[model samples]
Target: MILTVTLNAALDITYRVDALRPQTTHRVAGVAERPGGKGVNVARVLHALGEPVLATGLAGGATGARIRRLLAGGGVREAFVPIGGESRRTLVVAAGDDEPTGFWEPGPRVTADEWDAFLGRYRELLADAGVAVLSGSLPPGVPRDAYAVLVGLAADAGVATILDADGDPAYLGVRAGPDVVKPNARELSALHGIILGRSVTVGTVDGAVDAAAAIRALGARSVVASLGPDGLLAAAGERVYRAVPAEHVAGNPTGAGDAAVAGLARGARTGQPWPERLRDAVALSAAAVAAPVAGELSLEEYERQRAAVTVTELR
Candidate 1:
């Protein structure tokens, strides 16, 4: 089974309005809530694809209890370490044709004892898992090197690990040498001013290529950069493959990246070749875009993209 870690899980709230206008009164047309955060999103997509995946994180308070209840009802196994503070909530407003606007509340502070308790729990979960996905942000009071430390622990346990994060945590975690690290194009652009162990700025795929390679140099076995709408550029072993979609498949894009991560995790677990891995990643990503709801993938679109996606090895 694949294990997913979300240190800062949230209650995701989405509101649909007829038209979202700035500084104007509006009535909500619909409301939806779900357990969220990068790893939770990935777990949901993996479950939908019939993968044996378990999700764990820090949760507490009424909101956290609600998140767990939703996950349980949805059939996603969860093993969260209870915390003292209330879990945060993410609010999204969808109006007209405009892209959804989101407001995320800062998660509650984690105490030293709580963090220590989690370390033991995480290691226990890693034993039964083949791949561990460490994604999303660090909660308040947690160290910036939290992901890095967890990656090291996973490594020590002989488990393959995938890290999907950004900023300083991303840099530190990459330094810990996970099996794979995934960063979106924009995340690569800044990279916390460190690429190839040197300070630099990058935003484009071309720039990320070098950064991706640098991350590999830092100890990660491979790196995948998610290029929005374009597809994926994956560097594995000594080869790089560019997986491009035939056309844009657009819908709710919130969980597309998470879906892509799930593909990579599945590929890693099965020891699939780089090309096939890229195919799965791009296909799942496109399927997510074609999905009607958040955290869901269109199986039909997934199958079609599997056949239509073009994966070319880049020299």
Candidate 2:
């Protein structure tokens, strides 16, 4: 079973507008609410794909309860530790003509006692987990090295861990050594102190292979870098591969990365080869981008796109 850990769980609210203009009023065309946080999003996608997943995280107050109910309704098994503080809410305003704008709350403050309680719950859950996914940001009062600690615990239990996060938590988690690390181009640049938008384009097979090798050398048993419409590039051990999407169907791009991580986790649990894993990741992410809601993908769309995913082994 796939075990997912979300440190700062949230209730995600998305609003779609024809266009966003500062200091102007606009009518919202649609809205959607979902239980969110990177790991939670990942678990939801896996559950939709018929994978057995256990989502563990910190939650509190009415919003937390709502999130739990929503996950249960979606057929995802969850084990969350309730705290005294209220969980956070995130707002995504998608402009019909442009990229979505995000407003995020830092989340509630967690106490030392609450942290300890969460650790205890994690230990119990990790005992039977096959693959562990540590994702999202740390709450205000939680330690920055939270994912690092969980990485150590999962490793001790002989479970491969996949980390999808950013900033210090991601840097610290890498030091703890996870089996796989999925980061988008911006996050990758931030981790390595490279400039954002300064990506090395791979128009040729050899260039893609070289870039994949370079990414793997930075640390990580495997690296999957999502390159927007260019598709995804993956490097595992000495083998490198690139999977291109069948078409570019634009919608809300908010949860594409989380969906990709879910696909990768599902593939890992099912013993799918690296090539298939890349294909699934690309297809799922593409499907997510085609959906109007954040962190949700159309399963039928994913299945249709899955068959058209073109993967080339560059190594």
Candidate 3:
């Protein structure tokens, strides 16, 4: 079984309108809600792919309850610990032709007791999991080293771990020696103090490849950089593979990285070669962008993209 941990899970709310204007009241044309946060999103894709997955995290309040209900209705296994603080809700608005704008909550504070509860639960969950993923941010009151500690626990349980985090949590977690670390171009650039929304091209990709190497040297067993529409670059052991889609996809790219992480986890679980693993990751990411919402991927596009993905060994 695969285990996923969402330390800062949320109720992801999306609103679609003809146009969004400031100081104006607009009726939303459509509204969709789902269980969100990196790990939760990854678990959704994993479950959709017929993988046995258990998603665990911290949740509370009515919103948290709604999240649990949504997960249950979706048939995703969840074992989130209840918290004293209410969980967060993230809002994304898409106005016709324009880019989506997102409003995120800082999330409710989690006390020490709540953190301990999750750690104990995580330890118990590891026994049944062959792969464990720790993703997303640290909620208030939870230490930045939370992922690091979880990675260590998974190591002792003989479970391969994947870490998807940002900032200090990511920096610290990378040092704990997870089997894989998935970070996008921006996240990778942040480590080198060179983050700005740059174009995803061959030249820029080479820079990301270099950054990935630095991450691997920090104790990460492998590094996979999600390069948006350019596809993915993965390095494990002494092998590197770059997987690129045949064409660029445009749509909601919110959960693309999580989809890729799911694919990576699936490939690792089966011990597929690096090239096949990257091919799967890139195809799933493309399908995610074609979907109207996050978490769901278009199987039709996925099939095509899977065959369309071109894998090049760079090592």
Candidate 4:
């Protein structure tokens, strides 16, 4: 089974308006909500793919309850440890064809006892897990190196791990030697102290690969730098590969990275080659872009895009 850990899970809410004006109110045209946060989003994609997956995390209060309620019917088994603090809610407002504006709330603070409880449960789940996915930000009061701890535990349990995170958690987690680390261009730039953005150019792709190499030197067995529409750049050992989509896709790009993570984790668990894994990840990411919401992807698009993806060895 694939085990996904979302320490900072949330209820993702999207609101649609005719147009968003700074100082004015507009009537809501539509609303959509889903269980979210990086790992949870990954789990959703895996479950949709008919994979045996388990989502484990810390959740509490009304928001947490709702997140679990949504997950229960989503055909994904969840084992969330109850906490005293409320979870978080992420709001995104879509206005016409313009880019969506998002508001992310800091998740509730987790107590020390709650953290310990989660660790215990995590250890048990790792026993049955083939690949353990540690993703998202650390909630307030949780250790900054929380991902590292989880990675170490997974390693001890003989389970491969894929880490998706940013900032110190990511930096520290790399040193613990996860099987693979998937970071978007922005997150990779943050770790390497370089500037990377959504509009990834050829030069930026080179920069991202360089950053991935540096990150790999820190102990990650492999580093996959997600370059948005530019696709993925992966560096493992002395080999480097690039995977690019045949065409640029535009839609809600919110959970594209999570979909990519699902593909990567699935590949790791199934022992696919690096090039194949990158191709799968890139195709899944594009499929996610065609979907209206995060965690949902057009399978037809995924199938068509998979064949269209070009994977080449860089070195």
Candidate 5:
């Protein structure tokens, strides 16, 4: 089973309107809510793909209850550690022809006791997990090296790990030698700067690959960097491959990275080749862009795009 950890899980709410204007009140056209946070999003995508997944994380209060309820309703197995603080909610305002505007609430501060409880739960879940995905932001009061700790534990349990995070957590996690590290081009660039004190130009596949390789050298077993519409660049072992889509699909791009992480985690669990993993990840990411929300993917688009993905080796 694939195990996913969301340190800061959330109830993702999307509101659709005709148009968003400065300080103007309008009737909402539609509203949708789902269990979210990076790892939760990955678990949702994996479940949708018919994969056996168990999502575990920190959650509490009414919003956390709602998140777990929605997960159960969606048929995704969840095992969250209850806490004293309430979970957060993320709001997305989608206006016609305009980019979605997001308002993210700060995560609740976790107590030391609550964090220890989560660690205990995580250790137990790793026994049945073939792969563990540690993702998202570290909530207030949680250790900054949270992902690093998870990655190390997964390694000790003989389960491969895929880490998706940014900033200090990501820097520390990379040192834990996860099986895969999934970051977008911009995040990769920033991380590259953080780790090596060097600037990496974003939007160029070569630059992304170079930055990813630098990260891999720092203890990550492999690096799979997403290049938005351009696709994915994977640096694994002594090989590097580029996976590109035949065409771009337009829709909400909120969960594209998480979808890619789902594909990578699935592939790693199955021991697929790096090229094939990148192909599946790119296709899944494009399909996510064709969906209206963060957790859903268009199956038709997935099938079509999967076949059309081009995977080429890069020097």
Candidate 6:
């Protein structure tokens, strides 16, 4: 079973409008809400892939309760620690004219006692987990090394851990030696303090490959750098794999990375080869992008796209 940890869970609200004008009123054409946070998104995609997963995180207040309900409704197993503050709500306004505008509220502050309780719960869950995913940002009052500690604990339990985060948490988590780390182009650039180019066109695979190698030098066993429309580049041990999407499907792109992480974890659990893992990751990511909501993808769509995923070996 995969154990997913989300320190800052949220009720994600997404609104679609025909056009968005700053400081002007616009009627929304669609509104959808779901349990969100990077770890939750990963668990949702894993569930969609028929994997056994347990989502563990912090939750509180009525909003947190709603998040749990939503996860349950989506057939995800969850174990969230109750806290004293309310979970946050993130608003995403998808304007037809441009990229979506995201407004996020800071999550609840967790007291020290609450943090300890969560650690205890996590240790208990780790005993049964095959892989553990530590994703998303740390909430207020949580230390920067929180994910690092969790990764260590998972290591002690003999469970492979995957980390997906940004900023200090990501930096520290990598230092803790996770089994795998997934970062996008921007995040990878931030971590290594160098620009990895704006695009991975045909002429740029060499640069991308070099960048991925640098990421592996950071101590992670494997580094999977997601290149958005160009698909993904993964450096696993001594082999490098590049996967291209079967075809472009137009839709919202949120949660596609989390879906990719899920695919990679599922592939690892099944002992799949690098090429197969890349294929699964690309197919799942494309399916998630084609979905209207974040983190939710149709299994049928994944099946249709899986056969079309094209993977190439770079080394």
Q: What C-alpha lDDT do the candidate models reach, one value each?
A: 0.89, 0.84, 0.88, 0.90, 0.91, 0.87
**Who wins the TM-score comparison?**
5
lDDT of 6 by residue, 1-315 (tens): 999999999999989998888898888898999999999999999998789999999999998999999999999999999999999999999877588899999999999999999999999999999999989988998888998899899999999998999977887888788988898877776666532324332236676677667656766789888888889988897888889887777887889999999998898777788888888898899999998666679988888888998898889
Candidate 5 on 1-315: residue-level lDDT in tens?
999999999999999999998698979999999999999999998998999999999999999999999999999999999999999999999898788888999999999999999999999999999999999899999998888899999999999999999988999999989889988877898889888776656667777877888898888999988888888888888888889999877777889999999999999989988888888999999999987666799878888899999999997
Candidate 5 lDDT score at position 243: 92
Model 1 alpha-carbon miss at residue 122, Å: 0.4
Which of the two candidates, 5 or 6, achieves a greater lDDT against the reference?
5
List the candidate 4 regions with Cα displacement exceeding 4 Å: 22-26, 194-203
Models ranked on lDDT: 5, 4, 1, 3, 6, 2
Candidates 1 and 2, the one with greater lDDT: 1
Task: List, residue by residue over 1-315, the lDDT tens digit for candidate 1.
Answer: 999999999999999998877898988989999999999999998898899999998998998899899999999999999999999999999877789899999998999999999998999998899999999999998889998999999999999999999888988898899999888877766563565455576756677678788778877888898898889988888888899888988788788899999999998888888898889999999999888878877778899989999998886
The sequence of per-residue lDDT tens digits that candidate 2 reaches over residues 1-315 is 999999899999888898888999888898888999999999999998889999999998898888888899888999999988899999889776676798998798999999999999999999889899998889989998898899899999988899998878887787787888887776666565431235444445455445445445545678787778878888886777889998886777778989999989988777789999999999999999998566778899999999999999866
By TM-score, how accurate is candidate 6? 0.91
lDDT of 4 at 69: 91
Report the candidate with higher lDDT, 3 versus 5.
Answer: 5
lDDT of model 1, residue 304: 95
Number of colliding residue pairs in model 3: 0
Instruction: Report the candidate with higher TM-score, 3 versus 6.
Output: 3
TM-score, structure 5 vs. true: 0.96
As a whole number from 0 to 100, the lDDT of residue 89 in candidate 3 is 99
Order the candidates by TM-score, highest first: 5, 1, 3, 4, 6, 2
Model 6 stretches astray by more than 4 angstroms:
16-30, 95-98, 194-203
Local error of candidate 2 at residue 162 (angstroms): 0.6
Candidate 3: stretches off by over 4 Å: 193-203
Off by over 4 Å in 5: none
